[model samples]
Target: MSVAEPRRIVLFRHAKADWPQVTDHERPLAERGRKDAAVAGRRLAGTGVPFDLALCSTATRTRETWKLAVHELPQRPKTVYEERVYEASPGELIAVLNETPDDVRNLILVGHNPGIQGLAEVLSGSAEGDARERMTRRGFPAAAFALVSFEGSWKTLEPGVATLLDYWAPSE
Candidate 1:
């Protein structure tokens, strides 16, 4: 039997956003946000994981975060911006992942929180260790990144079925 390759998903929260002068959806990334995005991007790239696709939210800040993060990647992945991701619930985020094409194994989801954070926690389940404890205590902060790996198709993903491979956030 052929070995099944593990599927990986990277959940990233948008970097810091500028103060509100416009609608929430229109808020742009601040200078700090830009720098943070770059740092997070490099960190993600350093993991040596090649992303096959990126599913991003349509909001300006979210979109900008994805653009800046992907800049550090060696290969640019196909990206799709979905309106449903903006202010999405944890279930909604899972739904988005469920819809991904089966051929795309390594996928990234760049959006906001606590949806991102919540999804990370839910997927982590009872997999306890230093990383899980650390993430639990700190919570998923801005520009935080969580890499989860599972052994099946994207459509079959469910809570507590994936392991947290790594978690990181941009330095202050």
Candidate 2:
């Protein structure tokens, strides 16, 4: 928490939603998905983490999840559309994250599953702790998210270094 330190980035996958028949990217949140996202938002808001900014994919489900989750926060965070996130791999996400500006210290990225979970596991150094174990076993359910702390600047990121601060989902 020093002035010289860079801010942390937290990654979240959109909660359970109605998988749309139209297309994968066009899906919207189901009733339960909406409720779960709200609950998760409230829980995240209580953490006292301050996200200076947020980035989300253009997918309807991802967009909706970000809105609902941010609602519980004390202040609104500056947000942007990351077109690349719709089907981004962990490597792609890390690339986008590293390209972010230096002024931003804390950020939230809300996206989809598998990819997000993949990123979390790849970034975390070891798999001994409860968080790693749970991730390894469950593979991140819908609405699942992980708070990771990274060393060095956001522009200089590599895999297997970010520390997992917490992981949560509606089920647990």
Candidate 3:
């Protein structure tokens, strides 16, 4: 008999990317990004979202965005930086997730995209149309989150094992 693994992975695409004005890694959030992140945080908290682990890219925007979005949680989980996750490809993202500790029930990874979207599209068991479209729409906005469930253990999870559970984006 096969043993069951229990875990949920949440991927957060960093808030809107800054344009030509500043360096990519150093770009600060646009005014709206801050508000959007706060709202997103509240939404996550209000929904009673729980996660045992949190990982983030080392980039400035990702770091800042994650701080804002997760602030609404009643009890913050420990967050660590995954330097490989900075501007990483989908394969790289999956590798980091696969390495997560097995005891965690829920896990969150925050980084930039098209990497995030690429990872989401690759892992999701959801049909190509709706889940992909919604992620495309929501993932990049200032405050958006995607909740997905995978069919296997974090270490064994493959791209097609994931199912898009829910999505939320802060509205203006």
Across 9-112, the per-residue lDDT of candidate 1 in tens digits comes to 89999999998779999999999999999999999999899999999999999999999999999999999999998999889988888888888889899989
Off by over 4 Å in 3: 1-5, 127-133, 136-139
lDDT at position 148, candidate 3: 76
Encode model 3's per-residue lDDT on 93-158: one tens digit a residue.
888888876677787888887787777778777843475677676555555667777655668877
Error of 2 at 98 (Å): 0.8
lDDT of 2 by residue, 1-172 (tens): 4435745667888988896577888889998889988888887787678888899999999999988989999888899989998889999989988887777778898888767888888888743358766766677888887888776777677798777877777774
Residue pair clashes in candidate 1: none
* TM-score attained by model 3: 0.86
Pick the winner on lDDT between candidates 2 and 3: 2
lDDT for 31 in candidate 1 is 95
Choose 2 or 3, whichever is better by TM-score: 2
lDDT of 3 at 154: 69
**lDDT pick, better of 1 and 3:** 1
Q: What C-alpha lDDT do the candidate models reach, one value each? A: 0.88, 0.82, 0.76
